[model samples]
Target: MAKYLVEASYLSKGINGLMKEGGTRRREAVDELFASLGGRVEAFYFVLGDRDVIVIGELPDNTSAAALALKVNASGVTTCKTTVLLTPQEIDNAVMKSGTYRPPGFDEPYEVENWEGEGGHLAED
Candidate 1:
């Protein structure tokens, strides 16, 4: 299972619904939605500021997460931003792997005479 952090902002219609249905009802509805997708909600909170709600949960995979975002956004009630969560072990595993990558301008000639550009110069070994 993949964990996700979902931040949502409710639109006018969604706010109206929330006002009528209340917070617990909305959370229950969200829990039901996740269950239907074979996922589970770990935490849900109503917050202030830019986002109206925050949800932390685990879904089957990225596809399931995208599907949830698409369906909710399509409803015009709320807009969702989903972020995939990675554990510390996952980061450690990733760092253990090796890869060769050449950034742009890597092999290009640098005008040392006019090296007044940003980022300074590369040190010589």
Candidate 2:
């Protein structure tokens, strides 16, 4: 199982429906959805931001995550973004494996003074 960070923002229609049904109904709805995907929602929250809901869960795979996202998007009442989470050790291992690529472009030190003015380098043009 893999962990995912799922953020969702409800459309007006969905919010209205949720308001009508209340919290327990909302949890049940989410639980059913997760169960259908062979996953479990570890935590969920209603938040204020670009997204209305934040869900942390363990999912079977990327395909399962995409399927869940597609279903929510298809509902026409919410939009979602799913991020696959990685542990620090995973990142360290990735960094160890990234030695093949060579850096590109001018190797001179980047100029901080050149950026002091608004649209700085372009202004000289």
The C-alpha RMSD in Å for every predicted model, in order, reads 5.8, 6.6
What does the lDDT come to for candidate 2? 0.81
The candidate scoring highest on lDDT is 1
lDDT (Cα atoms) of all candidates against the true structure: 0.88, 0.81
User: TM-scores of all models?
Assistant: 0.85, 0.77
Where is model 2 more than 4 Å wrong at Cα? 106-125
lDDT of 2 by residue, 10-51 (tens): 889999988999867877887788889999999988888788
Superposition TM-score, candidate 2 onto the true structure: 0.77
Write one digit per residue (lDDT tens) for candidate 1, span 5-109.
Answer: 999999999999999999999999989878888899999999999999999999999999999999889999999999999999999999687665443657644
State residue 89's C-alpha deviation in candidate 1, in Å: 0.4
RMSD of 1: 5.8
Q: How much does candidate 1 score in TM-score? A: 0.85
Number of clashes recorded per candidate: 0, 0
